[model samples]
Target: MTRDRVPHILILGGGYVGMYTALGLQKKLRRGQARITVVDPRSYMTYQPFLPEASAGALEPRHVVVPLRRVLRKCDVITGRITSIAHGDKAVTIEPEAGEPYQLEYDILVVALGSIPRTLPIPGLADNGIGFKQVEEAIALRNHVLDRLDIAASTTDEDVRRRALTFVFVGGGFAGAEALGELENMAQYARRYYPQIGAKDMRWVLVDAADRILPEVGDEMGVYTVEELSKRGIEIRLKTFLESCVDGHVVLSKGKPFDADTIVWTAGVKANPVLADSDLPIDDRGRVSCAATMRVAGLDDAWAAGDNAAVPDLTDDDPDALCAPNAQHAVRQAKLLAKNIAATLNGGQPKEYRHKYVGSVASLGLYKGVAHVYGVKVKGFPAWFMHRTYHMSKMPTFNRKARVLVDWTMALLFRREVVTLGRMRMPREEFRRAATPKRSQRDGSN
Candidate 1:
């Protein structure tokens, strides 16, 4: 398509798909062959699996993120949200963080915009609920959890103390389960320093509409996770959902009611709403429809992957099945998508992306986990080791891997940092107040 100037490759959403796809292209394509431009709201890609550890203070929050521009030296990274795409004209409307919307022309388009948190219409949810998808939310939850401990230890009102100590999480997938486990583990350690509060003073509850937790690892492992969490005095509510969280009073579908200061929402995710405005083929669930080769169905120049794409699963014998949205598939799909794109660009035949499902591993806490690989099942320390080793190997870049290892090593040599920096959230409060004259001073001076 390039008669004179170089081809422009516009990649949407600098997440797992965008970042890895760009890396693959940089390695495969020749200089000036394709000018890659990545558009995302954030400048970095977050390693979501490590979010639980970051929230628990097991790893520094900054260590779990990869700077997009720093890694993709050959590509132009634009921190913005993609408004719409006109694939017919090979153009897109990009809304930058601090500028007017502009049209971006591209010969090749990669829609990796990814998914957003799927929220239900529940009372008071907007006022009290927090999500677990991003690094900021994880850090806020960490500080909020510790600050709750501080509140419980200092308060004399029984109701206030009880409310502050109660932590409620609504979901039982990898995100919810691991988050509850890690934070509970950290809270147990932090409780040691509080003379007024004991381990029994805190209440951790996990609720899910599904019958089992960690469904990716199969039934046996899921049951084992429930049992292990039960032994830690964590309450698991299956076949239930949150009805309301009005004014911090949570009401369950089972008719249980309780006052809670903390509410973490990790129910699930849906494709980014921006896709609804595009001309691409989207399925009923709002995911981009892609062929086995990861190219957008019926579109020669467009491709999609990750949580936002419904790619037919060739690995599954069932003809009706589509690839489950997860990091394992997303990472692998990014590579193949890039390869297929490159193949088409070079006038070569594109290959289909197919791989059997690799098994799942999840960390429960510092020295606890559950894993199922191939046909083998492991729990306790062995599973924990597998969890750490697998993620450490999968985490992008040698620099991040080294930093994560150092963080673990330091944790082993010393106690975990249990302090909360809640003040960081409102850093300008003191300054703002100091700048304002006192009421008495204002009157006397006048």
Candidate 2:
């Protein structure tokens, strides 16, 4: 065996693409051929498909995320942001959590930085709306919804109670639909505990500019999804957009106005903005342009994948078709990307990536789902079962897979916990109260 100087391989993000691609390389490469380094803002990779379950308290939040250092022990992990990339010089500037920025050089570069939630210049979006991408957001949303129920139950003012119970979600894609489905189900289940609040007291409205929802599952399944959700008392406002949301007052394009305490924005995501600072060839959509082999176009020793790269969809016959930004393609692309990288290091030609779209499955809530797989359409319990089975198998590591399965098994045998720890948002409340003895003394006359 010929041993060569270690080639430093730098992965820009610790997302699904970066983490999985590094795992593949660790297994394929020899003893001392290359050194792998991963950089990201977070120390864990979230299994996004299971986020709705986490929010609904069906799965523990800890089980849905994989710790990066524990999983990638062989690689160097840095919790930092890549502020800029100078691909022409094979270097990047990183702004870590605490300290001055520094530059590092590498021989091989993998630009797997993922997408960011796309936002519009709406009136109250920045102050009121929350996103559905991270685990923390999911947990916060769960607590927020339960807290709203508590508020509604305790308050006598009709307007305050109505606003607290109303949830407005802007987007009709899988994220928005799944989030709305799981949360609505959770709220319904929780309503039984509140004697003052009933199912009729709560309202869920899903707004989307697009004419249809769940486009990934086909037109038939999409229509079925709308019908199923409508039967559950969810208002589907298609061909509508949020005109303004100033001061919690939601004004729709159809001239309907209402007040909602909660607003979730899951409309879409665009490629990470950092790509614009690099010298690499970026497409019009602000994504790094790559060939079918996952190699960056017009650049040597450079690779890109996931949502940040605009790789051609060779499986589709259409000349202008690009791969959709979904977990299915991201996971598969990581495997092929690792292979091509290893082949390049071994002085071999890289293979082009091509795969057929098998199908999609989305969970509506516990025991309810919709799936369209390989020309077969299934709904209700069967589809929900398939949803869990597919995502459980796709989870990154064996440890996570076992933990997730245990969570599900426990939910089957025991009742799901519905207690909301709203105090998580105010971690320092007790300390502040204890420190202020004068205020407590003044109010203790009762």
lDDT score for residue 227 of model 2: 98
Q: lDDT: which candidate is best?
A: 1
Model 2 lDDT per residue over 1-446, tens place: 33235899999999999999998888888878899999999999998999999999999999999999998888999999999999889999999999999998899999999999999999999999989999999999999999999999999999999999999999998899999999999899988899999778898999999999999999999999999999999999999999888888999998569999999999999999999978999999999999999899987789999999998998899977889889999999999999999999999888987878899999998899999999899999999999999999999999999999999999999977788888988999999998766534565763
- Global lDDT of each model? 0.93, 0.92
Local accuracy of candidate 1 as per-residue lDDT tens digits, 26-142: 889987788999999999999999999999999999999999999999999999888888998899998988879999899989999889999999999989999999999999999
Off by over 4 Å in 1: 1-4, 441-445
- Clash pairs, candidate 2, are none
| Collision pairs in model 1 | none
* CA lDDT, candidate 2, residue 409: 95
Reference-based lDDT, residue 84, model 1: 88
